[model samples]
Target: MLHILGLTANFSLTLQHKDQDILNVMSLVESTKRELQKLRDDGWDSLMAKVASFCKKHNVEMLIMEENFVDLRNPRKRTNISNMHHYKVNCFCTVLDFQIQEFKDRFTEVTTDLLICMAALSPIDSFHGFDKDKPVRLAKLYPDDFSYGELLSLEQQLDIYIDNIRRDERFKSVENLGDFSCLMVKTQKHLAHPLVYKFLKLVLILPVATASVERCFSAIKLVKTAARNRIGDQFLSDCMVCFIEKELFDSISNEKVIKKFQMMNERRVVL
Candidate 1:
C-alpha cells in the first residue's frame, strides 16, 4: 500500500497539462498493472519468504498466524503459509484489475481528444509544436461560437500569429495561453491575430473542473449566513464577485471607488 501511495504522489506532481496528465495517468495504470502481474507471478513468493524470514529472525512469527490453527491432517480444512501467500496475491490482483479498468473507462477517446485540443495553446517551443488540427476540431465542436469562415481562417491566423510571436523577444517567455492573451491585450496585438485572439477567448472560458463553481457555492453559503440572509440579489452578486476576485478588488483606489459611487447617484456629502 505504501509503495502504491508513493507512486501516486509522484504522478500527481506531473499533472500540469490536461492532455499530458491523461497520458501520464494511463501510463501509470499500465505500469501498475504490470507490477501487480509480476507480483502475482513471482514477487509474491519472494516477498512472502522474505517477510517470513524477517518475522522468524525477530522471533515474531506468531503475529502472522491465525489465532486458531486448522488440522494439518485434513487437507480440505488446513491453511498453511502457501495458502496465505496465494490469498494475498489474489486480493492484490483483484484490486489492481479494478483500478486499471476504472482508469480506462474514465479517460475515453473523446475526452483525450478534447484535452489534446485544449493543450494546443501551450506557448512553449516557439508555439511551433501547436497541434493545428486539434484546435480546428475544437472550434468545430462549438459551431455556435465559431462560424465556418472563422474556423477555416484559424489555421492561417495561427501561422501568422505564431511566426509573429516567435520573432518578438517580448513574447519569448510567455508560458501559457493566459499569459499569451494578457500580453496580446497589453500590447494591443489582438488586431494582428483576430482569429487567434477569438480562439484564445474561447479556450479561456472553458471550465477545467466543477470544483471552482462548487467553491463559489460554498463561499455563497458562508457569506449569506443567518445574519446576512436578506441580502438582495445584486448586492449578493457584488459581494460574491468581491470575495472571489479579492485581489483585483483590493487593487482599486479608494478615490476611484468614491468617484464611481458619486457618479452613480446624487449624494448629500461629496468627497
Candidate 2:
C-alpha cells in the first residue's frame, strides 16, 4: 500500500486469500519499511520500483496518489534550524522556484510522445488545520503553474466536473449513479479511483481483518537475534523478503488436525 502524506491518501494491495492472513501481513510490513526508506533516499523513482516489486510478489495491483501541488506541501512547507554544541542543522522543504527550473529540465529529457501529469497550485491542507508557515518559493522538479488564490474545495470542483461528464451520451442508463452517495458517511471514501471504492465496499462487508499483516511483523521481531541488537535496515529487509514470499498454512486443511484430536478420544467417538 502506498500511504501518501499521512492518512490523507493511500493505496492498498490485495491478494484473494481464504484463510491464511499471517503471510500477507508479514509481506505488508516488510514492503512498507522498504518503501519508506527508499522514498527518503531516492524520491518518486525509487518509490515506484518498490511499489512494483511488492505488487508482483503478492500477485496484487497498485494505485498511486497524485501528490500534486494542491495536496503535497507546496508553498507551506515547514523549516527549522537546530544547533549542536559546534554544529548546526538547517532543514527546509524543497522550495518552488528551484523546483520549477528542475521540472522544465525534466520535460526536456523525457522521450514520451504524451506526458500527462496532474497539476494544481494550492495550499497543502486548507480544509482542516490552521498552519502558520506561509511559503514564498518551493522546490519544483516539474513545470507547474503556481497560482495562489481562494480555491474551490475538492468536493465542489468534482461536483461540477461530474455534472459536465454525466451529460455526455456515453452514460445512457446509469445517469443517477453519478449522484449515488450517502454523504453523511463521513469516513473518507477515496472516490478518486472507482476501484478503490469497489475494494473498500468488499472489505467493509467481509469478516476478515488485517490480523495477518500483524502476525508477520510479530514474526519479524522474533526473528531478530541479540547479535542484531537494534533490528537495523538490513535485517528488517531480509525478514520481510523471506516472510512475504512464503506460503502460509491453509486454514481449511485443518480438518486433519481436527480429526486427529477427535480420534485421540477413543472412548467417545460420536458419529
Candidate 3:
C-alpha cells in the first residue's frame, strides 16, 4: 500500500467463482500510469525500480523498503502476475485471477494521504503485507499528547486529516487503523497469485527504507516498563542503537573500542 496527496493505493488478492463454475479474474494493472517529472534524474532500473519511482512520483518523500519483502510460497506463480498501472492510489480484490475493475472501485472516490499500521512484531519474512497495522502509532509517541480515551477513538476523532499531512503538520491518524478495519473486511475480494512474491519483492527495493524503526520503538515501549520509564536518556539511546543494529556498532574496529576502553574501562565496559 502507498499514500500520496490524499490518495491511498492498496493491492490484494482472493478467490471467487463465476458463471457455472467458470472463473473471473481481476488484478492491479499499471495501465496508463503517469510519471512525476524531475523528482530524480535517474530512470528506473527494473520493474521494482519503476514502482519506487512511481511511488516517488506520488510525492511520497520517504519509503521504507524491506529485503525479500515478497513471499512466493507457490512455485507456479512465476508467470501468473503481470504489470499494473495507476495514475492514483486504489484498492482491489480478485479470486483466481487479476481484476483491474475491482481496484478502481475501491480507491476511486476517496483519497487518503496517510497510512497508519500497527508495527509488525516479527522480522519481515517476505513481501507478505498486512494493512491492519497502524502506521500512525509511532507518531503518537512524538510528544503529541492525546488522552488515552481520545487515542482509542482515533478514527472517529479524525477530522479529514489528509490536508494536515500534505502540509507536513501533525495530523491525528492512527497507524494501520484502515488496514485493520476497511481493508481487512475487504480481504476476500481478490485471489492470491503465485507471482505475488515477485511483485512485492521487486517493490521492497523501491521504498526508501524499511519501517523497521517503528517496530523497534514500539518494542521499546513494551520492554521499558513503568519501572524503567525514568531511565537515563543516554543509556536508552545507546541501547537502542546496539539492540536494533549492532552491525553499525560492529563496524567500529575493536582497536577503537580498546583505546576508548583503556581510558574509560576502569573495570567497566563502554562503547
> Which of 1 and 2 is the better model by TM-score?
1
- Please report the candidate that would top lDDT against the real structure: 1
Candidate 1 achieves a global lDDT of 0.70
Q: Per-prediction TM-score, please? A: 0.60, 0.20, 0.24
Model 1 spans with C-alpha error above 4 angstroms:
13-50, 58-90, 147-149, 210-271
Model 1, range 1-271, lDDT digits (tens) per residue? 5544554555545443333433345566557556655654565567567777888899974444334344457857755455454446456556656655665686566665666687776787677557778788888888998888888888778777777888899888887777889999998899888888888898777645434555688899878989997999999999899897777988999999989999999989996
Candidate 2, residues 1-271: lDDT per residue as tens digits? 2233331122133423433232233444445445444444456455457768989999986543332222134546432322221111111112222333443453342211111111111111221111112111111111232223212232234444344434544333321211222221232334442322332233233333344655666777667768767877886887776666566534335677677777887755442
lDDT of 3 by residue, 63-111 (tens): 3332222225664444322323111211111210123344445334211
lDDT: the better of candidates 1 and 3: 1
What is the TM-score of candidate 1? 0.60
Model 3 spans > 4 angstroms off: 1-210, 221-230, 265-271
The positional error of residue 152 in candidate 3, measured at the CA in angstroms, is: 37
Per-model CA lDDT versus the true structure: 0.70, 0.37, 0.34
